[model samples]
Target: MLLCLDIGNTNIKAGIFEGEELIAHWRFSTQRHRLADEYAALFLNLFALNGIRLRDIRGCAVACVVPPLRVVFEEMIQRYLGVNPLIVGPGIKTGIRLAVENPREVGADRVANAVATFRRYGGPAIAIAFGTATVFDVISREGEYLGGAIAPGIIVAAEALVTAAAQLYQVELIRPPRAIGRNTIQAMQSGLILGFASMVEGMIQRLQAELEEPARVIATGGLADTIAQEVRSIQVVDPHLTLHGLRFLYELNRRR
Candidate 1:
């Protein structure tokens, strides 16, 4: 069995895989100040609930965007799980070429997404992760990471708006009944949800235009389902894309 983790700015998604089958998975809020023992306790409790023991974990892989949490999880895994987890970063064997300007600057989560997308669906492909920052990662037809765009996530935009504006408060990020909002809440919803959907559509068109060919679009992250619900361009809403990517990379790069 392998333990795979995709640590993002907003959440830490962990999965326990028995062979290729993901047996158990869970998500926890990202707490930077949390101790290794504290994280271990929370996960071990989750493992117990799922009937997975610590020793059941043979190997581990991680794709962490938060640098501090990388070291923290490394320590936690070493102390509790007793495996030297493969932390995805530069020099990892992803089996996918990165054609970007600075591959080092690419997020591990993005690399994992690229590897998983190519392995599972092949390219050309676009993976949108709607987390702290809504990220778009493009994979070429040749299975290369071709880089994409980043935009403020809807929650971030909403929070910023609420902070800046005196009267507007946060509203549920659901699609408005109509584009022409009748009320303040409806207006905010229209701008946040429907507006993001339009951005997604336009971005897909622009990216597809640059590719000069149609590419499959997949989405992940906490808010992926919300945005994908309104966007017609998204073909798949795979919440665990990054986890599967970690699992695949573990098999590829683990010591023989």
Candidate 2:
């Protein structure tokens, strides 16, 4: 089985793949302070619950944005699975041309998401990833990773609002009946959820206007489905896009 891990800023996602089919997957908080043994124990418990064995893992791949956790996970994988993980970064064959000023500056998770999205739905395309930061990765008609914009994610923005305003409390990020809310909590929720959706739609529209060709907008990340549910502009939402990209990247690099 192929073991893939996507360590984002807020969450760590792990997937066990039996060939091309994902057999089991789990998500946990991204504990940057966790030790290698602690991470191993967490993985062991997850595997045990699903009737999977550490010895059954054939290979591993990782897409991590948290630099501190990279070595920790790598050490854990090596000790537990007896295989060094293929880390996604510069020099990785993602099958996409990065047009950014410094391609290395791009997050591995974002790169993986863009590569997978473009491959699945060829460019010109725009990928709105709802993560720690809501990222907009754009691909040109020629299939180049033309960097896009970034904004505070829904959760981050909400947290900021709550922290900055003493009167405001953290509310569930959900869409209300109307754009104008009736109460303070509803208003905050509406502003964060619908407002974020509007921000995405506006950015995408502006992006489309700037491009001569039309771009297909796709959404991914943990909060994708929830946000996309309310936003009409988002065309597709693939929660496991990063893992699929990691799998694709693994295959690409394995042959090389």
Candidate 3:
């Protein structure tokens, strides 16, 4: 079995794959202060609950954005699982050609998403990941990793609105019954959810215009399904895109 981890700013997503089949997966809040032993114990409990043992995992791959947590997981995997995880960064064999200014500046999670997108859906394609920050990664028809845009995540935007405004408080992120909001809560929801849906559609239009080619827009990350349901441009929502990408990358660079 292969254990794949995608450590993002907001959450840590993990998957256990038996061959190419993802047998189990879980998500947990990201705590930078957590120690290696603590993480190991938590992972052990999760694995036990899923009827998996540490010894069953032959290899591990990670795509981590949090530097501190990345080191913690690396240490935990080495000590507990007895496997040195394949970190997705410089020197990893990602089969896509990065057409960005500095390839190293690209986040590992974004790279994973690109790899999975091009491999699974082919290019021209766009992947919108709604995580700590909503990121749009574009792939050319030739399978090149063309850089895209980034915007404030839905939660981040909502928090900022609440923080800045004196009267407005945080509200649940659900679509309002109508675009013309009836109350304060509905107004906030409409502005956050429906506004973001429009933003996504507009961005897709702009990207397609710039690319001069039609591309399939795929959404991922925690709130993908939520936003995707409102956006017409988003064709597919694969929450496990990053996980599958890590597995694909691991396969590409697995020790022979």
lDDT of each: 0.91, 0.88, 0.95
Candidate 3 per-residue C-alpha lDDT over 1-256 given as tens digits, one digit per residue, 9 for 90 to 100: 9999999888999999999999999999999999999999999999999999878999999999999888899999999999989999998889999999999999999999999999999999999999889999999999999999999999999999999999999999988999999999999999999999999999999999999989999999888999999998899999999999999999999854
lDDT tens digits by residue: candidate 2, 86-177: 99998878888999899999999888888888878888998998989999989887789999898998888888998999999988776788
Runs with alpha carbons beyond 4 Å of true place in candidate 2: none
Off by over 4 Å in 3: none
In model 1, residue pairs whose N, Cα or C atoms come closer than 3 Å (at least 3 residues apart or on different chains), thus clashing, are: none
Ranking, lDDT, top scorer first: 3, 1, 2
What is the Å distance of residue 216 in model 1 from its true position? 0.7
Could you estimate the TM-score for every candidate? 0.98, 0.97, 0.98
Candidate 1's displacement at residue 197, Å, is 0.4
